[model samples]
Structure formats: structure tokens, C-alpha cells
Target chain A: MKNTDKSAATARPAPGSCSPGPFSNAKGPDHRGQAFTRPGSGQCMKRNSILDAAARTFCRDGFTGTSIDLIAAEAGVSRQTIYNHYRDKEMLFGAVVDEIIGRMNAVLYGILATFPEKPDNLEADLVLFATRLGKNCMCNQDGEFLRKLIQAEGERYPELFAIWRENGPARVWSAIAARLARLAHCGALDIDDPDLAARQFMALINTDLQFCGMLGEKPTEKQIEDGARNGVRTFLRAFASRGNPSTKADPAVKPNMALF
Target chain B: MKNTDKSAATARPAPGSCSPGPFSNAKGPDHRGQAFTRPGSGQCMKRNSILDAAARTFCRDGFTGTSIDLIAAEAGVSRQTIYNHYRDKEMLFGAVVDEIIGRMNAVLYGILATFPEKPDNLEADLVLFATRLGKNCMCNQDGEFLRKLIQAEGERYPELFAIWRENGPARVWSAIAARLARLAHCGALDIDDPDLAARQFMALINTDLQFCGMLGEKPTEKQIEDGARNGVRTFLRAFASRGNPSTKADPAVKPNMALF
Candidate 1:
């Protein structure tokens, strides 16, 4: 859909267009300044455009299933133009991954920035973040594409999986872990290992929510939401430091007679 | 090395001995104990041989890269026999997956059977099970073979993924959940939802112990074991039905729960 609108606008032959090629009109000496007046901005825009097209194409046809010709056709650019931007097929795949990771980070961080000061508000915000992340991860179009991309080349191009780990799940996980750790330290929450805690929190969401649905089953929106809510509540109960510390003594801190 | 030894055994051609075929001269038609034998045991054995060969070839060369000839040769059977057993490439792939799932179940069940007692022995037994399962999941030849098999066919034959989930993880998970639920009912443990708890437990083991190393990072034996221990302990802490119940007393419980 995004592709169609952009392509329709770019499809117009310019006012005095001689050729249809993207470069043909922009190449001549008279049109050099007109072509890239804001060169840096244009470059970023073009790169993103290519990445969007690449994502759609890869999502549809898979890595081995897709070709450069298809990506170029979808992007409304010449094959040469694509090469000018990306080194090869593998490199282009890496770029597509990078763009997705960047978009996800942007969305998640935006949600993070909106986190409220009150604990109740923070829980609400975190749940919102989780919902958005899950939606993205399990979207029919994007999810299928990601599954193909990761499952197909994971063995041959193991580094791609590692890069995905570093960029996608791990990045968000670490951020969440850090926040949980800070909360724990501040006596706002109670956790021994934030990393492990974060993973369990995620595991709870995943169990009844997305993993089965990803296989083939379609779960209701209410079911997914209810599961997420239950998961967060359960996690917080196990980790929250809001309870009376005097009620249960720490098993490890028993009778420090020497200090006394 | 197994292949080398087997191939070396087959390399020698003798007049009285049949060369590398399903039947050897040493074993003739069964005259005795026919009633005890399964009706299609001969065909089943032959089918299994082909599947074993297909698994080996697929692991080494991937689905697209492996050929029927290689599979046939490795199985010590003719190409026609393989084709007769499996109608097409996809069927052969499916058969291979079926065999792998069959083998995994056998191993997993065998291990689980060793400790039939309930409650106290379970934790120790679980540690042993994790060690074995982790080795199966993340170490050595069979693990690599399984990884390659899943990676190669997961996208192309996603139903294969379903089979894996159903036969492998889902089956084991449900069994564990039921066991834990029984323990909880007996007042030995505490848990609200056994299903969710089971998923959290498996995910904990998978993420902390096996997943990273399985994807290609080199983790030592000690590291894997340590990670597994920590994951299991954390999971137990999260879901163990102990002093605290899933009541309104949990301060972490939010009024508005967000479902992802």
C-alpha cells in the first residue's frame, strides 16, 4: 500500500522528461543541483525507500526466493541504483534487518519515553509496550517474512541470526532488564537477576499468547490481552518489593552475630 | 566417522555376500516366530533406513542441496526403492521429519522413564534430564544434525515446524505441566496455571541455557549447565505454589491489564 502511493507519484514523467530512467533526468549537468539539492536528506530518504521495498519483497518471496530484479521493480529504481546503495544480496538482507530493528526500536523507545512516574501508570505503559511488540512480532506479513529470513539462512549465515539477536530481541530485553534492575535497586521492585527476570516475564507473555498462534492457530485479541495482563501481574507479584519486608526475613541475611 | 566405518564395511564386494543392499546373505526369509513380527515390520524397517539416510544427507547438504541419489546411496538401497517409499521430495522430507520426531520422543521418554517416583526425586531427575536434553538440543553431532534439519526446512515446509512443536516441545511441555499440576494439587507445590508455568519453565531453559549456543555461539559445558541451573531455579521461584497465592494481595497486579 505504501509502495503503490509512492510509485504512483514517482511514476510521473517529469515536465520535460526525455527518458523514464530515474537517473536519466537527474544526470545532465543542468539538472545536477535540482537532482540533489539536499543531498544528505535525499540519500537517507532513498535508503529508507529501498529498505521498505526490500522488506515487502523479502517478506513475500523470502531470501532465496527473492531476486534483486524484484526488489528494484518494487522500489521503482534501476538495478544499478540498488547496487549503488547495497553491495550484494546478503548485504541487502542485512540492511533490511537493520531497518526493521531501527523501526522496532523507535516504536518501543517511543512507548518507553511515555512511561508514567506512578507504578500503576508504569505497569500500564509496559503492558502497552509489550502489546505493540507482540503485534509486530506476530503480524502475518512481517512475522512470516522474519520466520523465513531467520529459519532459512540461520545455519548458512549464522551471523545474521546473531545480528538479529543483538539488534532486535536482545536490545529490548536489555533495556527492560536494566529498568527492572533499577527498580529493584530503588526498592520499587525485588529481583535477584534482572536479565533472568526479564526473560521469564517475556516467557509468560509468549506461552499462552503468540507461539501457538504463530504455528497456525488464531487466538482472539481478548485472549492475547488477558494473557499478557495475567503474565505481568504474576511477574510483578514474584518480584515487586512493595510487600512488608518485616513479614518474611531474607533467608541469606539470618543472624549476622559478628556484625551485631 | 560412523559414515566412514559403514562405507568401509560396504566397500568390500564378495561373491557369496550381497553388496550393500537391504538384505545380506546371513539373514534369509524368516521361517520361525512370524506371529510375533509386525505385519509391516519389513517395510517399516526399509522406510526407516531411507529416512535415516535422508536425515544425514539433509543435515550435510540442506534440503535444496541434497539429492535423491545421495540419499539412496547412503541408505544402501536403489533410487527406485526410495521413490517407491516416498512419492516425492517433499514427502521424503516429511518422512525425515517424522523419523527425527520419532527418535527424539524415544530418547526423551526413555530418559523420563528412568525416574518414575514423584515429588522429591523430580528436581534431581530434572537436572539430569536437562543435562541430557541440553546435550540433545545444543551439543555434538545429533544436535547439529537436528539444527540443520530444522533450519533447512522450517520455511519451505513450515508444517514441519508444526510437527516439531507438536511432537517434540508441546508434548513434553504438557506432560511437565500435568506433573507440576498434580504436585500442586497434592499440596507439595504452588501454581495457578500449570500450562503457563510449563511454558515459562521451558522458555527459561531454552533462552538462558541452550538457545544462544544453539544459534552458533560457542558456550562451554560448564556455562550451559550453569545457565540451565539458574534458569530452572528462577522458573521454580516464579511459579512454585508456596507461601504466596495468586490473590489480590499481589501489589504488582494492575487494574488495567494490557494484552500483547
Candidate 2:
């Protein structure tokens, strides 16, 4: 919002996207039930392509602002082709959100399984877990897209998005809490309330990256790593077992942390 | 995005706004230089009515959606009357943002000043400080509006939002960092890298309230207080000096924290 609009419109660098290296969601792909379709099926591919385009467009523009014509152009299909798969614009949008939500939840649970139930190294393992979350679930295409759509359109379509937040993130937080409870059960950490600790852990991880995301900039892998490391370190300081020498705090020592 | 308009439309709840209580600015009002205007100036009041209308409309319907006609209607003024004060829509938007940004920054610093320089009771003092931040800065009208505008339109007008971010939040974070540094220096907390600690502190304060805000729900005073208490308790657990008995962690004690 400015007067005169003097900005010499320079090209904005497309935000970075990092494919997770060490983390893999190997729990069978296509959580949205497209898995049954044979890869060679033309119909399945066409459906997937339309959904992808819809997702991209909806994310860039709010639901009201997006049109079926825009989605068809984006998918490189005729508007008639789009109509063939989905009944109408509303249906198309639902399919996009549903597909991404399914994929997002699947990826989350997949990564949750990677949580170190028995960590040989507490600090490193926690950092690694946080990194996996950032790279795979939070910073990934589905995560970013859903977040944008919700923030932009939640007020307009509250109930529609309500399904999303409840089914996905609401349960997701509880799931994360359960995992922390497991850690506390084994005396790896000293968390009092697993739910509260879980929430803090999540918030801490975002502390380093929240600003960049709010500005629509994708974080680099280095940033994801640095953020993970810093967040995990603080988390350990807060909840690590006092008896555990590995994570024992030495307030005087400012150790240079590197994520391998 | 969803399919089939089968769901009956429901009117959206207009989001709540809280006038921050127990934390008055008190340091001469109107950070946007409206303080200099003599009270009851028709021109100044008219200008502000237009700005308030513009801010409300722009936030509700993003920059592209908002028009001079809409703002004029919202302000109860003739379109020409709005133009008389500001050059155009762009100019009006700028004035609205600038006024809010200035007010936001001032509120932030004013709250920051209340950070306990010497706390006889560390936990209580920190909770009080965090509550002040939440009520006065984050969840208030100016704070919520600017955040919505930035998120909705930052990409379209990257340069415009960039100034708000850099001037308001960037400096605000470092300013928070300085406060934490002072706290650490006084031996109340054990922190390395005040900047990192500062960011964590901000993130922690946001933890309990983030989800509600994302869903476009305004947090109640109770929620803000609960959030501050939970966040401060964790912050102390991570950084409070071991000698500080009030905030010292007890691995077995999951005390029900209460905020005064």
C-alpha cells in the first residue's frame, strides 16, 4: 500500500523448495486413494494433473478469486476436460484440498514413525526429527499451499476449512504429543505435560523460519537445518533429563552447532 | 477448495477485537503524528474516518479487491472527499498502513519497556510481561489488521510490505533480543545468543494462541493469559538461572500454573 507506486517492478526470486534428503515417506505413496490406479491409466493421470493445477492456482489466489478456466489453463486441459472429472468449480476445489490434506497427513504420520523411540544420541536425533518435519511436512508444497488457502479464505469458508484443521492439524498435534510422552516414559526427557511440551517443540522449530514463510519466501536447506538445530537445543535445555550427561546444559559454553 | 455448494451458506462471525486492558500506552496517544492536531478538527477527523474505513476494507478485501468506492462507502464520505485528503486509493492504503505500523511499533516498544528489569518474582513478572505483549501488540486491532494485509497482499506489493516488515518486526525482534539480553545479564536467566532466545521467546508466547488466530478467532483475555503463563513457564524452564527458585524446574512437578 503506497502512493505513486514507484517500485520498478523487479522479478521476484521464486521461493526455494528443498526435497528432504535423509527423510523418506516410504509408507506407500498416494494417500488420497489414487494408489489403486495403474500408472499407465490415462484417466488417472488426467485427474492427478487437474488436481495439481487446481492446488497451485488456489494457493496463489483465494478460492473466490480462482476460476475453473484458470485451473483448466493451468493444467493444460480444456475446461470441458476439467468438467468431465469434477462436477463443477466447488467440486474441483474440494478435490484439490482433499488430495493435499490426505497427502499431508500421510507424510506427517510417516515422519512421526521416524521419531527416535530409542535414540542413541538425543540432541542429534531431535534435530534430525525437526528437520524431517520442516522439509517433509511443513515446508513441502502441500503444507505451504494449504496454509495459504486457509489464511486467505478461512473467513469466507469457515466450515470447509474447519474439516481440514480438525482432521489434520488438530490430530497431528495430539500425535506429536503422544510421541513426546513415549520419550518421557522412557526417561529420555523430563516433560511434565506431553501436550504442552509438544506444542512448544513445534513452536520452537518455527521460531527461526516463521518470518521468511510469512513473507512468502521458501527457506533453504541450510536455514531449515540451522532452525532445527537451534530449536532442538533449546528444547533439550528445557526438557532433557537432568541426569542425562549428553544434553546437560553448560550455560557458559556456546557450542557451534552444525547439522550434518 | 471444495466441491458442490451443497452446504447451506452461513454468515461468518465477524472476528473479535479486544481493547487491551491493564496495559495502557499512557505515553501520549497517536504515534502517527495525529497527536499534534488540536482535538475536534473536522479535517483531521475526516481524514481518520477515511483511513479507518480504508484499513477495514483493505483488510477484509485485499488490495486488488478494495476500491475507492468501497472505502468511501465504508467511511460514509463522498469519493471526492477521500481523494481530497489522499491522492488516490494507493495513497489512502499507504496512509492506513503507515498509521497502524507506527502505532504497532510504539505499542511494542511501550510494552517492551515494562519487561521486568529487576524481578523479585521472576515467573510472575515474565508472565505479566508476555500478557502485555499479547494483549497490547499481537492480538489487538492494529496488530491483527496489518498482519492480515501483509499476508494477503505482500506478494502483490512486495516492496510495500517489505518496509512494514523491516521497520516493524525486524527491529522489533532485535529490540526483544535486547530485553532478553538484559534479563540474562542480570543473572535471572541463562541464555546464549540473545537473538535466538528472543525469537524463541516470541514464538513461545504465540504457541497457545496461534491455532485460534489461524482459524480467524480472536483469543479471549483468558486465552492470552493462559498462553503467556504457559509460554513463560517453559521459557523459565529453559533459561531461568538454577538459583532462581521460583522458576526452577521440578521434573516431577506438573504444577497447574495460574496467571494473576
lDDT by residue (tens digit), candidate 1, B1-260 = 35545434433223113222221121322323222223454754555456666776676567766789877766656777676756677777765665556556666677555422455644445556665666655454445565555544555677666766566656666777787788678765667667666666666555554335433454556555655565555555555556433211312212111110
lDDT of 2 by residue, A33-147 (tens): 3433345546545565667767777777766667888766666567776776666677667666666766677788788887777746878888899999998877887888877
Error of 2 at B62 (Å): 2.4
| Alpha carbon deviation, residue A257, candidate 1 (Å) | 51
What TM-score number comes out for model 2?
0.77
Candidate 1 residue-wise lDDT, A7-75, digit = tens: 344432221222111211233223122332334545544555456567766654556667888777666
Off by over 4 Å in 2: A1-44, A67-69, A249-260, B1-43, B83-87, B246-260
| Candidate 1 runs further than 4 Å off | A1-62, A67-88, A111-125, A137-148, A158-163, A217-223, A242-260, B1-62, B65-88, B112-117, B137-165, B210-215, B218-220, B243-260
**Per-prediction TM-score, please?**
0.63, 0.77
RMSD of 1: 14.5
How far residue A122's Cα lies from its native spot in candidate 2, in Å, is: 2.5
